[model samples]
Target: MLRFFTRSVLSLIVASASTCPARSSSASRPAFIAAFALSPPSAPSTSCQATMTASVAAESTDLPRWDLSRFGFSSPFSDEIDLHLEETAKLAEAFKAKYEGKLGELSLLSAIQDYEEISKRKTLVSSYLHLSYDVSLDDDTLKKRKGALSQRQSEIYGDNLEWFSLDVAELDDAVLASQYENDPSLTKFKSFIDELRRQKPHNLSKDVERALTVRSPYVGNRPLVSFFDKELSLMRFKLDEDGKEVNMEVLLSRMQSSNDAAFRAKCLQVLNEGLAGSVSRTAALSLSSVAGGWLVENKERKYINLRSRRNLDNNCPDEVVDSLLVGVRSAGIPLCKRFYTLKKGILQKTQGLDKFRWSDRNAPIDIGGVSNEKISWEAAVAMVKKGYNQFSPKMSEMFVSMVEEKRIDVPAANGKKGGAYCAGVIPGVGPFQLLNFDGTKQDVATLAHESGHGVHDILAYEQGYLQYHPPLTLAETASIFGEMIVFRDLLAQSSSKEEELTLLMSKIDDVVNSVVRQCSFDRFEELVHTAREKGELSADELDEYWMSALREYYGKEGDAGGDSPFDSYENTSHLWSYVPHFHHVPFYVYSYAFADLVVGTLYNNFLTNKEGFEGRLLALLSAGGTKDFANALGPFGLDPTSSTFWTEALTAHLGELVNEAEKIAKELGYVE
Candidate 1:
């Protein structure tokens, strides 16, 4: 069986399809709650404070939201977690003793079964530790334990299973095919085996692999990445809020819909200054180290190009990703330009602004009919449930059950991580969602988006450890689709044209974010990673790379030359310092564009055939990592490899939204 080991963390609220605007490169992207900072929460509405408090009280009473005990653990310090770790360690030793240096001689069934058993146990323990740490990064004990356990687990895998894939890859194709035909048990592992074989050319000698693995903890880029996250998390930025000195998080939340452009601009200035002054040097060094490691590996591996390494992991063909990039850039950038132009016009008419700042990218257009009031927790849940239930009752039930079981941590508190992500622990234990929910429409969409990931996790649990998680290319299917479903439903219920326009513009922003902005980020990554081969990049060089990408995508404001409304790129240069993805997972940002286009295409099909779409969509999610990207989308008649797929999806879906919003603007007299 393909063991499903699922980890789902998506950040919502980058009006462009990202968790955060900073997510231009994988190094800068957050791992789980990628978008936690993209959209700030609404100020608690004075009118609904009582109701909000009551709802929080009612929800808080049901503590211990996640059922970690199902995995034979409760907390990070629980005896069960330690006992499980000990058991896993022993199993690792026993497995190593049995299989080391004898892998080619063992029957395929025996090899797979042994591997599966060991992986399942290790996943259970490690997954629990990860969940505990994500929810409470401030807990030093838990943080240390998570790190120690992760290192130990890595060691165990290295020591015991270092040769498994290389050996499997070395097997004769005919012999492997014969084994598969003779042993029915191997059928489920076909995808896993095929993916392993893809790495055959790059596989190192067992000794070298083991050596690298053993020294990995100290020599790898992880330490640098960890330092950046720790340093950024610890550095406090003081913002004057209502004459009170508060942390950056407070200002970020207040800045979202501050109604005061000056205040928002100041908050943006403070954020940039703080990150630039204290964090940029560390971030620049980390990126250099990470990019340097990639260059070294690329040379050693002798892969086709800079991205072949990540392409192998994603099981994506080079042509497909190339097509995706070209298609998105050609189709998405112009549409992005059009949307921003419309936005500038509307904001100018509504807010009386001479020109907009980068901070005003997500500024709300105050329409007479739209409500900017804070949504209560209860109402947010109801809205999400209603929206989801419109598509699938099963999905709606999943959201409700998460709430009832307390599987969601929904408040922003000191020491709690920013952003939101669905961490799907091992099978038999449902997924847990972490959110800094601040009761905004974006927050509700985030609720739906992360819930979509939880649903995908729940469905994919049957695939077991190796097959449970989809590649990054297909990873955002359910989550982005969830956002679309909710957004459409919300638009359907809008009472006026202005309200509808607000929702439409937001969704369009998300699509552009996901597609155009992310592709631009990918372009930056390609440049920087290529540049890093020459030497380490200084902070200024990194800023130059960022500004170059912005100009290409957003364009310059005046002279009628480019897409942007201003030339304020200098202030946002340090923005790259905070994205977690770029540091940890290179070449991963394109997956957002890949997912957005795929989901947009799939969603259009669903609209055409609503009666039969649910089953097919569910089946796609359930396949998990067992199928490659093309096969997963085959049912929807979407070919990601084709340029048409990307261009048509962008024009038909995102372009339509932009066109409709323009029409609405003209109708409302905001534009002619």
Candidate 2:
């Protein structure tokens, strides 16, 4: 989970329970991988890179490390810590003593400097051992403190206080914008401040606004909705064919290894049981309530629809988002379903092929294990480097600097989360990544994906902290495009049918998840919010609504009208509980679906029009936090304002997948 737009000392990092940092406010906090949600990859092999497991803590590594001194963090933690309540109280006292209502440039500069110092102290909090304060990622004390700081931050940033001075309003909006012209670093601050001023007329009284800003952390849903997503360390599922114990992740990813329906069902059951476990269910409830509360507030905020606030924050226009959903659901979701039917026919089954298990979607192909062998870590790194280099020599160069310089710390080690992520520390300093690097082909792609994020962060970092992050809707461009690069390169190298099939199927599955699943989540959130506004949503009521949405996206369930016992009470109460977004930001899911197709368009353009394409892409990445989604996309001749813009992008890819899936089915002798 990460924030693209953090404004206070509390909004910095969204670390896990192990290294808990106070997340951003309810309005702006990004959810866990909500920015780049990757479902667990096909289970990895010791030899092949696949999905790695999520574990609890980091182990010591002997690799050469960065100075880390340049970031000004003497310790690993990023801010100052109060080892005890007295110390924290002192911090509160200090702020109140010196910072309550001082409205001068000098006062603001002092606050920023103090925050920078606090960041340095916070990073090394562990280095000093805050063992006595009860510091679980779920630590009660941490929650309390974060709640305090978050509330304070909200009071400041909410419609409560003026983010800028009255002096700003006195200058012409044009010349006022020019006030930060000399320094690019100040431009974003200037803009954000100006935006706040524009809404000054609608703001609560200054005292009320300041009070809201200061007390926001203490409010909202996350506090009441606490759930843990326990990482899997060791898991064994019974394999149907061999009757041998198999790693669930690995076995599920290898569904193509065997044509046994029994095996697929077993994998699904295993996964189902895992999510059905008591702890997971309880967590889901918390997530749902949090999401429900978010819906309530959105109604209060008076946004156009449940999804509109997210669009506004992403700086995306409504039409572009709508277009992406329309094109994908119409073209991509159905194609994915059709491909499943073809697989069923080829595999000698017909009863329930359309009911896809999470496992079978990306099973390793049965091309005699050809072309899908485990790639070495070096090979994965090289592929990513080459892909980035092909795009921009500088971008590629940064990849090397990161890997060789120990800027990256991925090797799929124990205690790291299952997926990959890039954390941009700041400008001048580069970003860091955490990855589970088993040697599967997907692992390599994951590297490319996160590296895409890494590259974007590096370029964006050029804009300094104020402009370093992109809006969520545009954040995935580099990462997904990075994936496209790897996929295209691999496609070029696939000399045989099996490898090509593997590539096509993989692409198809990705399209389904990104376009269909995420958009469905968006729609689901809308329902939850809309329903919650009318009345309080019980767990049963929430489940009923969830299944309704889930069925619509996946397909109507055959057992629905028969009063399935597990439908509400047992099925997916945790749907809302575990994901931090429902608690933090409502309707954040649309960004993924939007960004996925958008990447398709950008990649399509680059593939068809090579000259200056890389340059334009770089320019976009470099604009960072400053550009809205429209402006970020301007140079590429794209606009989210037009429904046609999104449809064209989705059509280009899904149309081909549908055609290829059909051809494959026909060749495999499946009936029309």
Query: What lDDT tens digits, residue by residue, belong to model 2 across residues 1-672?
Result: 122221100000111000011122343222211111111111110001112222111233542333344444343222443333225335545654564455332334444344333332322222122111111223455434444433333332332212233233334556544445534455445443443354333333445434443443344343444223222333345645677654433443444333454565565555545545553555445555666655654554555665665565555666666776776667656655665555545443323344434334444345424654567768888988887776678878877877876665444333233333455544555465545444666656666766666777788875545446676766677777777787777777877655676577666656655567556666666677677656656655655666676666666533455321111222233343323344434455555566667888888778788889988988888877677777777888877677576666666776676577668656644546
Candidate 2 Cα deviation (angstroms), residue 412: 4.8
* TM-score attained by model 2: 0.74
Off by over 4 Å in 1: 1-13, 16-67, 101-105, 241-248, 559-563
lDDT of each: 0.67, 0.49
Q: State which candidate has the highest TM-score.
A: 1
TM-score of each: 0.90, 0.74
Where does candidate 2 stray beyond 4 Å? 1-24, 28-191, 194-219, 224-226, 230-261, 346-359, 411-418, 534-540, 557-584, 664-672
Positional deviation of 630 in candidate 2, in angstroms?
Answer: 2.3
For residues 357-387, write the lDDT of model 1, one tens digit per residue: 7777777778875777888778988998999
Candidate 1 lDDT = 0.67
- How much is the lDDT of residue 668 in candidate 1? 93
TM accuracy, model 1: 0.90
- Relative to the unseen true structure, what is the C-alpha lDDT of residue 28 in candidate 1, on a scale of 0 to 100? 13
